[model samples]
Target: MSSAVVGLLIQELPKGGMMMTRTLILGIAATIVAAPSGAFADTPAGNQQAQNTSDAREIVCRRMPPPAGTRIGPRNICRTQAEWDLLQQQNREEVERQQDASHYSRGN
Candidate 1:
Protein backbone atom coordinates (compact mmCIF):
# COMPACT_ATOMS: atom_id res chain seq x y z
CA MET A 1 0.00 0.00 0.00
CA SER A 2 1.11 3.57 -0.54
CA SER A 3 2.49 5.48 2.44
CA ALA A 4 -0.14 8.19 2.27
CA VAL A 5 -2.99 5.66 2.23
CA VAL A 6 -1.41 3.68 5.01
CA GLY A 7 -1.07 6.84 7.07
CA LEU A 8 -4.74 7.62 6.56
CA LEU A 9 -5.74 4.13 7.60
CA ILE A 10 -3.61 4.33 10.72
CA GLN A 11 -5.30 7.56 11.68
CA GLU A 12 -8.75 5.99 11.27
CA LEU A 13 -7.93 2.76 13.12
CA PRO A 14 -8.32 4.13 16.64
CA LYS A 15 -11.97 5.04 16.05
CA GLY A 16 -12.92 2.12 13.76
CA GLY A 17 -11.68 -0.85 15.79
CA MET A 18 -10.07 -4.06 14.53
CA MET A 19 -12.83 -5.25 12.16
CA MET A 20 -13.04 -2.00 10.28
CA THR A 21 -9.27 -1.69 10.25
CA ARG A 22 -8.91 -5.18 8.82
CA THR A 23 -11.50 -4.50 6.15
CA LEU A 24 -9.88 -1.27 5.05
CA ILE A 25 -6.41 -2.78 5.04
CA LEU A 26 -7.58 -5.74 2.97
CA GLY A 27 -9.38 -3.49 0.53
CA ILE A 28 -6.34 -1.32 0.04
CA ALA A 29 -4.11 -4.34 -0.49
CA ALA A 30 -6.53 -5.69 -3.07
CA THR A 31 -6.64 -2.36 -4.87
CA ILE A 32 -2.88 -2.07 -5.03
CA VAL A 33 -2.57 -5.59 -6.47
CA ALA A 34 -5.40 -5.15 -8.98
CA ALA A 35 -4.20 -1.83 -10.28
CA PRO A 36 -2.21 -1.67 -13.53
CA SER A 37 1.61 -1.80 -13.45
CA GLY A 38 1.71 1.72 -14.89
CA ALA A 39 -0.74 2.90 -12.23
CA PHE A 40 2.10 4.87 -10.69
CA ALA A 41 3.81 6.25 -13.80
CA ASP A 42 6.72 5.84 -16.22
CA THR A 43 8.60 8.92 -15.03
CA PRO A 44 11.32 9.11 -12.37
CA ALA A 45 8.81 10.60 -9.95
CA GLY A 46 6.60 7.57 -10.38
CA ASN A 47 9.52 5.23 -9.86
CA GLN A 48 10.45 7.03 -6.65
CA GLN A 49 6.85 6.85 -5.50
CA ALA A 50 6.76 3.14 -6.21
CA GLN A 51 10.00 2.64 -4.34
CA ASN A 52 8.58 4.55 -1.37
CA THR A 53 5.51 2.31 -1.40
CA SER A 54 7.65 -0.83 -1.36
CA ASP A 55 9.81 0.61 1.40
CA ALA A 56 6.73 1.46 3.42
CA ARG A 57 5.57 -2.14 3.19
CA GLU A 58 8.94 -3.51 4.19
CA ILE A 59 9.28 -4.13 7.93
CA VAL A 60 12.17 -5.52 9.92
CA CYS A 61 11.50 -6.93 13.37
CA ARG A 62 13.72 -8.38 16.04
CA ARG A 63 12.83 -9.75 19.41
CA MET A 64 13.92 -7.90 22.50
CA PRO A 65 16.20 -9.72 24.88
CA PRO A 66 14.98 -11.22 28.14
CA PRO A 67 16.37 -9.96 31.40
CA ALA A 68 19.09 -11.89 33.20
CA GLY A 69 18.31 -15.30 31.68
CA THR A 70 14.75 -15.20 32.95
CA ARG A 71 12.05 -16.23 30.49
CA ILE A 72 10.07 -13.13 29.68
CA GLY A 73 7.52 -12.12 27.10
CA PRO A 74 8.75 -11.55 23.58
CA ARG A 75 9.12 -7.94 22.52
CA ASN A 76 9.86 -6.92 18.99
CA ILE A 77 11.69 -3.90 17.64
CA CYS A 78 10.81 -3.07 14.07
CA ARG A 79 12.07 -0.65 11.42
CA THR A 80 11.63 -0.14 7.70
CA GLN A 81 14.11 -1.62 5.18
CA ALA A 82 15.76 1.73 4.46
CA GLU A 83 16.10 2.47 8.13
CA TRP A 84 17.60 -0.95 8.80
CA ASP A 85 20.06 -0.57 5.95
CA LEU A 86 21.24 2.84 7.11
CA LEU A 87 21.68 1.60 10.66
CA GLN A 88 23.66 -1.42 9.47
CA GLN A 89 25.94 0.72 7.33
CA GLN A 90 26.53 3.15 10.18
CA ASN A 91 27.43 0.26 12.50
CA ARG A 92 29.83 -1.25 9.97
CA GLU A 93 31.57 2.05 9.43
CA GLU A 94 31.87 2.61 13.17
CA VAL A 95 33.39 -0.83 13.61
CA GLU A 96 35.89 -0.24 10.83
CA ARG A 97 36.85 3.14 12.28
CA GLN A 98 37.40 1.57 15.68
CA GLN A 99 39.54 -1.16 14.16
CA ASP A 100 41.60 1.44 12.31
CA ALA A 101 42.08 3.40 15.49
CA SER A 102 43.18 0.26 17.32
CA HIS A 103 45.68 -0.56 14.58
CA TYR A 104 47.08 2.98 14.65
CA SER A 105 47.45 2.82 18.42
CA ARG A 106 49.30 -0.51 18.09
CA GLY A 107 51.71 1.08 15.55
CA ASN A 108 50.62 -1.33 12.82
Candidate 2:
Protein backbone atom coordinates (compact mmCIF):
# COMPACT_ATOMS: atom_id res chain seq x y z
CA MET A 1 0.00 0.00 0.00
CA SER A 2 1.36 3.40 -1.03
CA SER A 3 0.86 6.48 1.22
CA ALA A 4 0.21 9.81 -0.57
CA VAL A 5 2.29 13.01 -0.53
CA VAL A 6 -0.11 15.94 -0.06
CA GLY A 7 1.40 19.07 -1.64
CA LEU A 8 1.68 22.74 -0.47
CA LEU A 9 -1.55 23.85 -2.21
CA ILE A 10 -4.33 21.57 -0.93
CA GLN A 11 -7.58 23.38 -2.00
CA GLU A 12 -6.16 24.93 -5.21
CA LEU A 13 -4.97 21.58 -6.51
CA PRO A 14 -8.53 20.80 -7.81
CA LYS A 15 -11.38 18.45 -6.96
CA GLY A 16 -10.39 14.78 -6.32
CA GLY A 17 -6.74 15.74 -5.64
CA MET A 18 -6.57 12.87 -3.13
CA MET A 19 -7.44 10.43 -5.93
CA MET A 20 -4.70 11.90 -8.14
CA THR A 21 -2.25 11.68 -5.21
CA ARG A 22 -3.08 7.98 -4.63
CA THR A 23 -2.77 7.26 -8.41
CA LEU A 24 0.70 8.82 -8.52
CA ILE A 25 1.75 6.83 -5.44
CA LEU A 26 0.41 3.59 -6.97
CA GLY A 27 2.25 4.27 -10.24
CA ILE A 28 5.52 4.70 -8.33
CA ALA A 29 4.86 1.51 -6.35
CA ALA A 30 4.26 -0.49 -9.59
CA THR A 31 7.48 0.92 -11.08
CA ILE A 32 9.47 -0.25 -8.06
CA VAL A 33 7.92 -3.74 -8.33
CA ALA A 34 8.61 -4.10 -12.08
CA ALA A 35 12.26 -2.93 -11.89
CA PRO A 36 15.08 -5.47 -12.33
CA SER A 37 17.02 -6.20 -9.15
CA GLY A 38 20.52 -4.63 -8.98
CA ALA A 39 22.10 -7.90 -7.80
CA PHE A 40 22.45 -10.57 -10.51
CA ALA A 41 22.96 -14.29 -9.88
CA ASP A 42 25.98 -16.00 -11.42
CA THR A 43 26.29 -15.34 -15.17
CA PRO A 44 28.74 -16.65 -17.76
CA ALA A 45 31.50 -14.31 -19.01
CA GLY A 46 30.43 -12.05 -21.93
CA ASN A 47 32.49 -13.78 -24.62
CA GLN A 48 31.62 -17.27 -23.29
CA GLN A 49 27.90 -16.43 -23.79
CA ALA A 50 28.32 -16.47 -27.60
CA GLN A 51 30.38 -19.70 -27.43
CA ASN A 52 27.59 -21.80 -25.82
CA THR A 53 27.00 -25.16 -27.56
CA SER A 54 23.21 -24.93 -27.12
CA ASP A 55 23.01 -22.24 -29.83
CA ALA A 56 25.13 -24.33 -32.21
CA ARG A 57 22.91 -27.40 -31.66
CA GLU A 58 19.73 -25.47 -32.41
CA ILE A 59 20.48 -25.41 -36.17
CA VAL A 60 20.37 -29.23 -36.20
CA CYS A 61 17.59 -29.51 -33.61
CA ARG A 62 15.27 -27.38 -35.78
CA ARG A 63 15.62 -29.85 -38.68
CA MET A 64 13.19 -32.33 -37.10
CA PRO A 65 10.08 -31.79 -35.03
CA PRO A 66 7.81 -33.88 -32.79
CA PRO A 67 6.17 -36.84 -34.60
CA ALA A 68 2.74 -35.33 -33.88
CA GLY A 69 3.54 -32.21 -35.97
CA THR A 70 3.82 -34.54 -38.94
CA ARG A 71 0.98 -36.93 -39.98
CA ILE A 72 -1.95 -34.59 -40.46
CA GLY A 73 -2.55 -36.99 -43.43
CA PRO A 74 -1.43 -37.72 -47.04
CA ARG A 75 -2.62 -34.24 -48.09
CA ASN A 76 0.19 -32.59 -46.13
CA ILE A 77 3.46 -32.66 -48.17
CA CYS A 78 5.89 -33.52 -45.35
CA ARG A 79 3.46 -35.64 -43.37
CA THR A 80 5.28 -38.92 -44.04
CA GLN A 81 8.77 -40.33 -43.50
CA ALA A 82 9.28 -40.63 -47.30
CA GLU A 83 8.83 -36.88 -47.74
CA TRP A 84 11.28 -36.09 -44.92
CA ASP A 85 13.85 -38.52 -46.36
CA LEU A 86 13.59 -36.88 -49.76
CA LEU A 87 14.00 -33.44 -48.20
CA GLN A 88 17.16 -34.52 -46.38
CA GLN A 89 18.54 -36.17 -49.52
CA GLN A 90 17.98 -33.00 -51.55
CA ASN A 91 19.69 -30.88 -48.88
CA ARG A 92 22.70 -33.26 -48.85
CA GLU A 93 22.99 -33.16 -52.67
CA GLU A 94 22.87 -29.35 -52.67
CA VAL A 95 25.58 -29.18 -50.00
CA GLU A 96 27.79 -31.54 -52.02
CA ARG A 97 27.36 -29.42 -55.14
CA GLN A 98 28.37 -26.31 -53.21
CA GLN A 99 31.43 -28.12 -51.82
CA ASP A 100 32.41 -29.36 -55.29
CA ALA A 101 32.11 -25.84 -56.67
CA SER A 102 34.31 -24.51 -53.88
CA HIS A 103 36.89 -27.29 -54.44
CA TYR A 104 37.25 -26.37 -58.17
CA SER A 105 37.27 -22.62 -57.36
CA ARG A 106 40.30 -23.26 -55.09
CA GLY A 107 41.97 -25.21 -58.02
CA ASN A 108 42.01 -28.42 -55.95
Give one digit per residue, the lDDT tens place, for model 1 in 9-102: 6766766477777677878777887787667556687788998879866998988776776778778889988888888899999999998888
Tens digits of per-residue lDDT for model 2, 2-74: 2343244333456767777656756876677556453454467885666554443343322344367676343
TM-score of each: 0.41, 0.28
- Taking all chains together, the TM-score of candidate 2 against the true structure is 0.28
Model 2 poorest ten-residue lDDT run:
1-10
Return the clash pairs for model 2, or none. Answer: none
Clashes of 2: 0
lDDT of 1 at 3: 67
* Distance from true location, Cα of 79 in model 1, Å: 0.9
Each prediction's Cα lDDT score? 0.79, 0.56
lDDT score for candidate 2 against the true structure: 0.56
Show model 2 residue runs off by greater than 4 Å. Answer: 1-15, 38-108
